[model samples]
Structures are given as C-alpha cells and as structure tokens.
Target: MEFFADIADVAQVKEMQEWLPLDGVTTNPTIVARAKKELFTLIEELLAACEGIVQVQTLAYSTEEIVAEAKRLVAVEPSRIIPKIPCTQAGLGAVMRLSKEGLRTTVTGLITVPQGLFAARAGATYVAPYINWVDSMEWSGTEVVAELLAAFEAYGLDTKVIAASVKTARQFRELASLGTNAVTMPPETYKTILEHPLTDKALRNFADNWNGVFQEYKLDSKLKG
Candidate 1:
C-alpha cells in the first residue's frame, strides 16, 4: 500500500521524506492557506522537495474553473501534480474531462459508495474517502472503505482508494486491514505507528548491553571503509 503525507508545511514534508518512504502529499484549501505564501509557488516547492506526486485541491465551484486551476498546476509541474477534484457533480465532470485529456486526477472528499462509483466512472486515478470526517458524522468510515473496495473489484475499476483524514494509528491499522489502496495521514500519526512501550524497552536493553561490552573497544583506523 502507498502512504502519503497529509501535510502543508514544507519543513514537515522534508522531515517526513527524510524519515519515511513517502509516496506523495495531499493538501486542500485550508492546508494551502496555512503557509501564508503564494499558493502555487509553495505547492511547487513541496512537489520538488518530495520528488513525488502532490494532490492539490481546486477551490472552484464550477467545472471550468476547476479545470482551469488544474491546468495551471500541471503547467507548474506536469508530471508530479495530481489535481484533487471533489466527488461532486462539477468536480466529477472536470475529472472526466481532465482524465480524457491524459491528466491524472484524484477525486477526493468522498463519503459514499455511490460517490466512489461515480469517481471511478469519471476516470479518476485515485478516490479519496475522508475516514475521520465520515466517522465524525457517526457513520462507519471503515464500512465506506469496505464497500468501495468491494465495488471496485466487482466492477473491475482501475481507480485506487486513498483513505484520507486518518486521525490515529488504530484507524490506520483498521483501514489497512480492510485493504485500502493508499492512506494519507499527518506525519505525527505515522510516527506513532511503530511506537510501543515494549519495543522501546527492548531497544534500551540492547543498547545497554552493547555499551557494557564495548565500553573501551573501538574500531581501528585501518578497519574504516
């Protein structure tokens, strides 16, 4: 499964890249506005820093306007930007057009199986289901993911499901168990994925043992590579 950083800050993006095998980055209007800089410029910097596809959202309400923003993003980095269109009527329309023109698109903001089906029909390369967002509404986010996965296989759609708005490691593990194609989460959440008291205690024991044995031992200069 592919993992993406759901972050907007460039420094955090760089740190995530340095630590993990990041596949991409995802951002929305709220995220973009956090930088307080030129939108596309910041996005381009992020794409270049990570050297991976960055899903950038469109704030437009119409299909034409959405496509226009997508076009501008592609012009910035044709091969590394995936226009993030919502799974709305106009958004799907724009996705259909953009996909037909050979541009990769990520249809985000999905909450239902029908929305996922429509996104696949519109030829989106990826479908993002907001896991926590749906669960916040007291809906089964895992159910949404499960239904979409089954529908995609039943219909033989090539579109991938990107589980978005992931809040915790438990949610991430559950989504992975449900077979989500990809997941986008905050860097902090990803860092906690492998954190456990037992693991830390074991590492400390190993380090203490090693230090006890190698207190005065050192590699000779001739042994250095």
Candidate 2:
C-alpha cells in the first residue's frame, strides 16, 4: 500500500521525506490555512519537496468553478498535481468533466459505499473516505472501507481508494489489512505506527550485549588485525 502525508508544512514534509517511504502529500483548506502561507507559494514548495504527486483540494463549490479552479491548480505541474474535489453532485460533475479531459482527480469527503460507487462511475482517479469522521458519527469506518473495497472489486473498477482522516495506528493497520490502495495521515501518526516498546527494548538489549563483548573494539577494527 502507498503512504501519503496529510500535511502542509514544508519543513515537516521534508523531514518525513528523509526518513519515511512517502508516496505523496495531501492538502486541504484547513491544512493550508495552518501553514500561514499563500496557497500557490506553498504548493510550489511542496512540489519541490515531495517526490510524488501532491493532492490539492478545490475551494470552489459549483461544478463550473470547481473545474476552472482544478485547471488552474493542475497548470502548476500537470504530472504531479491532483485536484481533490468533494463528494457532492457538483463535485461529481466536475470530476467527470476533468476525467474526460485526461486530468487525474481525487474525490474527497467520502463516507458511504454509494458515494464511492458514484465517484468511480464518474471516472475519479481516486476516492478518499474520511475514516475517523465516520467513526465519530457512530459508524464503523473500517467496515465502510472494507465494503468499498469489496464493491470496487465486484465491479472491477480501477478507481483506487485512498483512506483519509486516519488518526490512530490501529486505524491505519485496519485500513492496510483491508487492502486500501493508499492512506493519508499526519506525520506523528506515521511515527506512532512504526514504533513499539518491544522493538525498542530488543534494540537496547542488542546494544548492551555488543558492548559487553566488544568493549572499545569495533567490528571492523577487530577484523583488521
């Protein structure tokens, strides 16, 4: 599965890129607003920093406006920029129009199987479901994701599922198990997913054993003589 950082901070993105196997970066209005930078300026920085595609959500609500704004966003970097449209009637129309033009688009804010089905039928390149948000509404976010995957497989659709709004490592693991095409989460959540107390303990034990046996002599130094 692919891993994407759902962040807008350039510095944090650079840091994560250095250590993590990041497939891309995803951005929305709220994430961009937190960065306190102009939209286009921030996007340019992200384009340079990210090694893969960068998802930019459209601010417009209507079909025509959404298509126009998506065109403007894609003009920055045709190959790397993917416009994220919300899951609405207007958004679906925009998605269909953009897909027919050969431009990749992601339908965000999804929460139901029918929504995903419609997005796929509309020719979306990707469909993003807000996992945590669905759970907050007393629904099984992971189950919803599972059903979407099953439905896509049943219909043989090529629209990839990119699970969004993931908060915990368990949620990440659950989505991964469901064979989600990609998942976007915060940098801290990625760190948490990679860490375990037992792993740290095992590393510490190995270091102690090596020090007790080798003392000041390094492995290469001992081999030199």
Candidate number with greatest TM-score: 2
TM-score of 1: 0.91
Model 1: worst 10 consecutive residues (lDDT sum): 216-225
**Which candidate's lDDT is highest?**
2
Give lDDT tens digits, candidate 1, residues 1-225. Answer: 898998888899998888789898999888888878788788878977797788899889899999998898888788888989988999999999999999999998898889999999899999999999889999978899999999999999999999998887778888989889999988888988868889999988976766676643344322212
Q: Summarize candidate 2's per-residue lDDT along 42-130 as a digit string, tens digits.
A: 99999999889999999998999999999999999999999999999999999999999999999999999899999999999999999
The parts of candidate 1 lying over 4 Å away from their true place are 209-225
- Candidate 2 weakest lDDT stretch, 10 residues: 216-225
Clashing pairs in 1: none
> What's the residue-level lDDT of 114 in candidate 1?
96
- What are the clashing pairs of model 2? none
